[model samples]
Target chain A: GDKVKQSPSALSLQEGTNSALRCNFSIAATTVQWFLQNPRGSLINLFYLVPGTKENGRLKSAFDSKESYSTLHIRDAQLEDSGTYFCAAEEGQGGRALIFGTGTTVSVSP
Target chain B: NAGVIQTPRHKVTGKGQEATLWCEPISGHSAVFWYRQTIVQGLEFLTYFRNQAPIDDSGMPKERFSAQMPNQSHSTLKIQSTQPQDSAVYLCASSLQGEDEQYFGPGTRLTVL
Candidate 1:
């Protein structure tokens, strides 16, 4: 079983629409981080969550350690939102490197 | 400042040949990570370095994969014998801390024939 399992392996949305992405953890996660891999292949850090919720612009993310889950919400999806979204989680403080889940590919069209 | 830098955006090698990929992390970043991305497996952690030392290479294949961080700025991943299965995009990323939101460089695509 995967330590971190991300749902909605792929998603398609219309411009100005909204959607949600999720990640379920098999291990107890202490913190979670979300990233956006744009079409140019650049990974931009979207949010760093610590068992709570965070929102920036049209993007919002939440992490629940007790529930072992995290979510990314997109509002007013734009063409530029088409790319891959990845979530990584760490369990403890002992050199606990991040374990990433399979990314969710998002495509927004007209 | 220029973020992470990686050379040779595209690489092609023959079967059984050796391939080396280079990455230069952001200045003053203490942690660097390597990952291999494929359509099927998505992004797989390959190896990483912390404070110019190997932190964990458990994700790397013991037989043919080796990685080293010679200095604070640069790290290299070497494969002893390349195979078709090794053809994937190798991505490099760096973060101020060993575990956090890492900044990534544009991946280097490797093709084997």
Candidate 2:
């Protein structure tokens, strides 16, 4: 089984609507990070978490290590937000290596 | 600036040929990571290096894949006897440690024919 799993392999949302992406971890993740890869193949780090929630602009993310899961929420989806979303999990204690999930391709229709 | 740099935004190689990808990490970053993204598997971790030394290469293929960081400024990933299935986007990222955000470069997209 994959250590990290992402829901909704692809998403289509209308601009100004809300959408959410989720990641479930089977491994005992010590940390989690979410990233967005633009169409140009440039990946931007969105959030780094350690069992908590954080929000930036219209994006919100949460990580729960005890249950082994993470979620990324997008509010007021915009065309500029359309991209592939990926979440990576790190399980080994004090280790920085990450196991990436199969990304979710998101497209915001205007 | 404040980002990782990768050269040769794209490359094409023939079957059984060799290819090399380069990455320049941000100054002062101690840890560097390499990942491969494909349409089928999405993002896959390849290896990681810290302080110019390999820390984990378990994700790399045992046959034709090798990576090295001879200096703090940059690193290289080499593939010998490339196959068509090896085509994918190779991304390089750098971070200070487990705490800082990992900065990624505009990946090098490889096409093997």
- iRMS per model, in Å, is 1.9, 1.9
**Real contacts retained, model 2:** 0.74
Show where candidate 2 strays beyond 4 Å: B98-100
- Could you tell me the lDDT of residue A7 within candidate 1? 85
**Residue lDDT tens for model 1, A1-110:** 99999989999999999999999999989889899888877778899888899999999999989889999999999998999999988778755567889899999999
**Per-candidate DockQ versus the true complex?**
0.64, 0.67
lDDT of 1 by residue, B68-100 (tens): 898898999998799999999999989887766
Q: Model 1 captures what fraction of native contacts?
A: 0.62
List candidate 1 segments past 4 Å from native. Answer: none
Evaluated on CA atoms against the true complex, candidate 1 attains a DockQ of 0.64
lDDT of each: 0.89, 0.90
Q: List the residue pairs that clash in candidate 1.
A: none
* Top lDDT model: 2
